[model samples]
Target: MLRSVPSKSQILRYVKGLLITWKLRWRGVDCEGRVVVAGPAPRIWSKGSVKIGNRVLFRTTSRRTSIAVRGDARFEIGEKCFINDGVEIDVWKSVEIGPYCFIGNNTRIADTNYHEIDQGAGPRVDSISIGRNVWLASNVTVLPGVSIGDHSVVAACSVVTKSFPDRSLIAGIPARKIRDIEAADDYIRPG
Candidate 1:
């Protein structure tokens, strides 16, 4: 789990993070527990009125470790949220993640497609809201306007383009319900 190694810019970023943490305390950002921010903090943003509760972690150590921030996009994380390595949360609009959500490694969650699909140039954005206890496997790409319900498990390499109901086990390239998770007695976790 080696990163490119923190550069001098990282050293400066570390100092800025210390200041931001202190400032957040003044602004009522609760962290009585801990927020283990991995990588050079420059790769992560703590702005746009972020309200983080206790036990939240942000990490940027993956194949493409880059976090994009635009406008005053907000990100609110609930308590005990575990964001895995290389997970990119691009907030062009707003992205609100609930508590106890375990985001998988290399999963990218972005509000917009980052380009005009029609190529005519028109604004398009839809926020993403991930519910509590949602387990996402590696290489999952959660697109805009998708709201994953609580206890729902998204399999690896799936592309979530739409919302799913609560407690559903979805899989496939575009992501579909294989079967009711309760119907299975031998559920397996992705490696």
Candidate 2:
């Protein structure tokens, strides 16, 4: 279902939210509690549904921060999550990001790429789930039926077509597990 046209009140509230979001960042928004950026402020939120938990960071910068969610789509975020700027999540079924996850800039997360190949009746909905503490690099395209396990890192610009097991480092066009992520100096998060 497509999102209902934005109401005048929604527009006003979105502008207001944008200003407040900036101020909050300047003042350092709270990072230890649940927060929600509802009603599609950074981008159009018609038909878009978002759920944020404690300490979740929605967007960093406002440029290219567009999220186009069709009707009947859901975006669910867990605690201590960071979704960088310029990220687009086009949802159909639901996109669930576990706690302590970090989604890099310019990342695209969608349940379905488009309507079924043979038929254009409508886009099918799928769910994208990112386990806890998963780190995704920039320009990654996570397609439908894909899930990344906890403590995993996906290299930049990789197209994920399938799910990867936990504690793995995946990269490349189709996204293969180059190696199981071990102790590292560049990217390391508390257990």
Candidate 3:
């Protein structure tokens, strides 16, 4: 098999990603493994802890992606995860994403409401745990305190408010379990 060489644009993108990764590491972002920015660079603001695992691709070809960690909050993305353009993760408490997860474009995952309903109290803060091999489609919004089990697929434009079991195919405005994915491990996108 003949191997094709990367184009000039691809080379440039890789170089830019390397620079961005170095900058982020200087700014206290903990990247445990090799991260590839296949698209545009992402905006990462980490005041607490933001750990990204190996072979994690941030593909923001259309728009910029953002990850913010405030106070003592921790944001973690496991190995072989793919995060698309315009995706944002705001961690006020903690937000953990397991391995081989796919997050589509314009998705938002937050661990806080960001503001207090009552004047005297602080904002509602909770942790979010997303299991391994989960696929979240475009425009999906995962709210605070939500725990999505392994091998789950959240359809486009869905709002995940609560928890769901393993291998669930969830969809809708307030996302519900539409069906169970029996062959969750069988589906894999070709390179």
Evaluate model 2: give its TM-score: 0.71
| Clash count of each predicted structure | 0, 6, 0
In what order do the candidates fall by lDDT, top score first?
3, 2, 1
Decoy 3 TM-score against native: 0.88
List runs of model 1 lying over 4 Å from the truth.
Answer: 1-33, 37-42, 59-66, 119-123, 182-191
Quote each prediction's TM-score.
Answer: 0.72, 0.71, 0.88
RMSD of each: 7.9, 11.2, 2.4
For model 3, where is the 10-residue window of minimal lDDT? Answer: 182-191
lDDT of each: 0.72, 0.73, 0.88
Residue 160 CA error for candidate 3 (Å)?
0.6
Off by over 4 Å in 2: 1-41, 44-49, 62-64, 119-124, 183-191
Rank order (by TM-score, best first): 3, 1, 2
* lDDT string, candidate 2, 1-191, tens digits: 88899999878756665564555444433223434353333553536565556755566445445656567677767787777788888877888888888888899888886866666556655688898789999899999888898889999999999999888999999999999977443343752
Q: Please write out the lDDT profile of model 3 over residues 7-120, one tens digit for every residue.
A: 999888778767867876888888786678976678888788889888789987789899988888899999889999999999989999998899999999998888898997
Lowest summed-lDDT stretch of 10 residues in model 1?
Answer: 182-191
Answer with 1 or 2, whichever has the higher TM-score: 1
